[model samples]
Target chain A: MKKESISRIMSGIDDEYIKEAAAPVKKSGNIRRYITVAACIAVVIIAGIILSQADIISPSHFSSEGTTANESGGGDKKFPETATEGTAEAPLDSFITPGEEIDTELAIESVTRPKWEDMIIPMRYGEITLGEITYSSQCTEISSENILSKLGEAKMQGYDIYTDTYYTVTGEAYSVKSISTECAVAVRIDNGEEYFIYVNSWYEPEDLGDFISDLDLKNTVLFRKAFIDEYKHSDTASEHSQRVYADFDDKVIWDMLEDCLSAENTEYNHPYDRIGIETDMPLLGYKNISFCITPDGYIITNILNTQKCFFVGEQKFREFDEYLKNNVPYKEYNTVYELNPDGTIPGKGEDGQSTPGFNPDAPVQISPPYDPSQEEAMSNTQQSSSPEIPQDFIIEETTRTE
Target chain B: MDDSKIITLFFERSQNAVNELSEKYGRLCLQISVNILKNISDSEECVNDAYLALWNNIPPEVPDDLKTYLIKVVRNISLKRYHANTAVKRNSFYDAALSELEEVLTADVSSENEVLFKELSEKINTFLGGLSRENRTFFVCRYYYGDSIKAIAEKTGNTPHLVSVRLMRTREKLKEYLRKEELI
Candidate 1:
């Protein structure tokens, strides 16, 4: 009501007061001023020069030889400076654009967090008993058995979820400190006390030593510690330990990404390993792990918002099957060929070293998961002294173009 | 012509009274109209209509300040049009001004609070009268003229931040004044 009233005030009339004699209106006569002779002469001269140039200019100068009049960049000679907008059904009749740079759009539906009663279940880690081990959100709610089933299905589908263990030693930089939102849950016991139930050192086996200490969960560190300790030594630990190197600071990782993007502006070191983010696709502030690559080989690894892993050895980290296993939203068609001038991906290669040109045939040729990879890697490769282009990719691209 | 001459023309029922008013306040009325309406042709028509409205109301109305009366008339006319058209196509400039005030002054438009709008308007006018000349002009430029902060700064020759701060302080003062008036 106040807003409407105040707005009314902005529009309302002021009350009439007893008047003093009003001031009479001033000049009604038009006072015509002449243009200065010098100004007239200058205008005439400028107009003459403009008019003369219009006739002198050639049609060849206004060519659309190298410009993208439309986003398609179809190389149409008759391209207008303005966008060539048409119906969606309009086929590529005139121009053929270079490279596939289309991003798929999929609507994301948000749901409220799942009910605690349905989510609660008994679980044991070492001697510590858990009231519930699963975090049930509208998007993600899976029991341990469900998770195993998912991994098993992925394996049956030839997702290479297990063979990725081979490249675990080739690690770069990753945040082992954080756990996936799927693994984040609550532990409500029979004592009627609800304590914190978080991800133990399960993700980063290397950080298992201080995982319990880092949690500081309700002064029950000893109890959590015993449980974490047992998980660290279990068969899962031996199996997944090689992949999880624990130096990731969830708090400081974004700062690292900023540094990797704009390194010279600040004093922060550029991690040779790139954090390939969906510059366009921001899923609930979760930097949906697209894919990061070194220079030589490519791999589409894990897509956990919490775990940012390093593509240790190969530049083309080809673990797309692993990416498919995680039910995160991302478009498969939106790919770019990113070649860092420094020879390696942001954190994957050595510091500021000269890297080779893009190999269209190599795994790196295919692993650009998002748009920023083109921007970050292209900027890096553009400045580098040693930029190599493989003969095969050039021939292949040319053949396709023809 | 002087104020006495214009008032005399109004009293004598002369057609020159309308012409004189146009020469003196046509631009000013158009400015007030355009501030809210954001349409040139519509604003021009509104100003012309204000002159006609003035001609009809003058002998009985007997305004002390011609400038204020004209401003008030044009603002009211423009706002009527604004209310009518805002649902169809929103004027960002006028909407921005209203939203800025909306942050501090809120009435849910409930049946109980319907009259509160008019009361609040009266209180705001009283509050404006209490402010300094500079502060009053600053407040009016934003809420009345519906000018952008950058525009107010440019015209006032103050920095945009300074103009914004002054407007903020004035709104704060208005808030306190309204609270004391029990209109909040």
Candidate 2:
């Protein structure tokens, strides 16, 4: 492992192999080389000719109508009108005087207006619907008889059923807007006016009942409303809302979930009972879920099972167990522990804010009491007592040693 | 001595050009070829081919860095032989090595080869130092010895990709370290 040893070994490799392997490079004569070079040049010329022809043809496909209209229309529109269109009131202009007469009539006339007949049909905002949900290994199917019966009633009432995927809310910055035993919904608001909602559910073929029981639908709706209200006053709400949805679609949320699961080393269990996740602190409710990663840190999955649940949903939990067996690739371990056997949460305690008995190996210790004045006096004493060494002396000693 | 003079000597059917080239860069070419091919015969053939090619091409082509040019020729020849001998059964070890070089090339195309060679030399040393004793031994035996992926996997008790990924990550880390040092 020493530097010298490695260099020696690297240098000591035999020379005969290099000479023998390089023999073929000398055998290929000038005729073959010339032909290869000529072929390459011909290919380049042909490619250039084809590319130039393609470039000439490409411009015909794009129409100037849309571009010209957008540009001219944008230029002719008065600033005041556009400002009013964005919001009901005109934004205050620091540079312009309020009493200045603006030529609104000519500007209004130049801008094209929709015909009265064309305005008859009401415009509707597109609604993003929750589709089938899929679950990774971390999430489990929830089983609550009450939720199952409610789902059955809802289905009978003609509510369309869909699939869902579950992800733990690792950070408070992102939380689910709604939950059912079957799914959890997260909403993001854009520009205070638009809303993007993501509904996640466990998607094994057989465990529909358990999935339904896991979500607390009422809390989800509340969370969605709260999120919308928080963003309504901000200018970025609309953009942020779209970004949130895009984040989910782009698998950013899933990727973050995977990171959290691996880092936490806790099994991603199914959504907690409606009673558990429906609290005022939905963010905290997310932290209660567990995730575990494989030893080599590749695959992550949920480790908790039915026996771990202390509530009165045993029969419904059994249905979930059966469903998982029939639909999902489920593996059972001996027992799931709430805390790691090492007694420390995987990622906490670096800054010493961790709970007591958190880590057995390196328990976080309480800092000794501080007296600022005393510490300042001690620092002064130490500085005064210490002798400064000459830089030249230090250099001389180092050079001599080297 | 000038490369043209050596080439002129070779073209004049004098074996002195080969002798001069061997005297100048015999050890360096051997090191590079053996590093890749890990065979004595292959390395020797590559060096000889480099000399013969130098003799034939030197009238028109003049190399600025004779050592690098010769090493490159030897490396290419050795790799060709390695590929032909091993066929498509190549695994993570070769892939990792190529990927490391590719990553270096892609990240900085200007002065890539020089920067890569320097960084690689430094990084391999750093990586060896950073590893646990067992891992260090395993790494040397695999990379330095040109041991196959299966051999490395069995010895280190790790999956081949794990080893490959680790090596790839180490190379990236080295590049990063070199960047921090302003070496690349």
Candidate 3:
């Protein structure tokens, strides 16, 4: 019996058997395969659309080396036309485990992580000592100038300022994850209606610190006001700590509080952890607007009983007493700003005329060691419930062409 | 299940390892055998033999590629079966597969280089690597998988004539590649 030498060469089938195995199987029948083909086309189209809406998927690489790779005839195998000049990183080469064999090309493609580049959310991070007041200030969506300047001073004082694209960033009073690679921050935005991964790696992915700020922001007020503005807005009260509840309009306070939240798509549910009988709850949602303005002027829209004008003994305001009977977390009202508490309905003074607190000339300072209870609650309130960013900024497609 | 997980199951001496391996790669193994032998029952036996081979060899050789490892075993078993069967009756996809390459690749009766076949194989590999992905796939289906030209045509939605012509051109290319490499 003669031996065949070509059989030796045939043993090394360069075909991607692993890839073929990994591909979704379609063995129900021909009809199923046709449906799968249709479904795949739909997925590609949808991926293209949402891909355009955000900076995901590899970019449309224009190369001079475009060759017609369509084969004339043979078995059911397909290969993407891989341009050697393309900038899109191949999943195979981006990661390499330590001490793993580098020689074989056969088993490499299966282990690649889902594209890390897809998760980056371009965010500005800084190490600043502008005091705890900065948290509330930044929460108000005050101009970045105050923070930038303070950050600049902090930088001049030798603190590092980093601007990095994160898979995610969680801001309650401040960014929850200082390191983007540690874990994904699940942020709920669009009023807690959707979830998006804040760039994180449970596997400790490589940190590509791609940019550094050289701006001498020390001359700028970015640091001191990074969170809290150094300058008072025209809406501020001139009097010594004018009562914030009697001062700013409800909409103005709500909008200011709203500005700090990173817009996310997580569906917001009125977070109430009540274990009582279901019949005991009254309307269970959007009952009455309770208000507490933080010492630093951050408006807590729920009944805090801690602000300057803590109590308004109006009868009608007390009529909605059943809703406020249970001390549900105050932030739960964040979803119901439409039913704002009326100042006219809830009297502040016996001869209610106008409000105070807005002094254009005076800068508001919220001294720390104030409201430790609320601060503790803010820390414990799962960043999972908070918004990702103030608004969905149509982030430029980091990889793909829009 | 992951390849390492399956391998770990084997190391732990769990009987489930064989079940998982057979479940995952059974179709692939059967396809390789059926492509060569053309008999369903014979193909089934070949697949079982391939599994046994993998079950025995994996302790000594932990392959990075479980899928490829199984396919190689199935392919070798099927080839040995085909060669043994062909001495009596020259009937199978295996014969039809070798008949085409018999013209361009078979050793010349006049030539006497003992290492010529090994040299030819290395040269053929280099030659296939240089071809377009389509042409290389056709070559693999015919020689490696031992698929009939008509079956390849049906699968690829091409006429049998087109596949025949493509294969003929590829064989010509291989001859030239070997001659240029001085392996002929």
Highest DockQ against the true fold, candidate = 1
Measured against the true structure, the TM-scores of the candidates, in listed sequence, are 0.33, 0.22, 0.33
Candidate 2 on B35-129: residue-level lDDT in tens? 56666677788778877777777656766555546765665566556556654314424334453344433333232355444554555565445
Runs of candidate 3 exceeding 4 Å displacement: A1-9, A12-402, B87-89, B108-115, B154-159
lDDT score at residue B91, model 3, on the 0-100 scale: 60
Off by over 4 Å in 1: A1-4, A11-402, B87-89, B110-115, B176-182
RMSD of each: 26.5, 31.1, 29.4
Estimate every model's Cα lDDT from 0 to 1: 0.41, 0.35, 0.40
- Whole-model lDDT, model 1: 0.41
Question: Which CAPRI level is candidate 3?
Answer: incorrect
Q: What is the TM-score of chain B in candidate 1?
A: 0.84
lDDT of 1 at A73: 25
Ordering by lDDT: 1, 3, 2
Worst 10 residues of 2 chain A by lDDT: A393-402
Q: Which ten residues in a row have the lowest lDDT in candidate 3 chain B?
A: B109-118
Q: Write the per-residue lDDT of candidate 2 for residues A1-402, one digit (tens) a residue.
A: 222222222322223322222221221323433665698778766754664454422222111111111211221222222222212111111221334322333324434333212321111111122322221121111222112121111000000001011111111002232333223322222212212222232221112112212333123212110000011122211101100000112132133222221121122235332211111223212323322112122222221211111122244334333332243331111111122234443234345465442333542222233334465774364335323311101100000000
- DockQ for the candidates, in order: 0.11, 0.02, 0.05
- Tell me the number of clashing residue pairs for each predicted model: 37, 56, 52
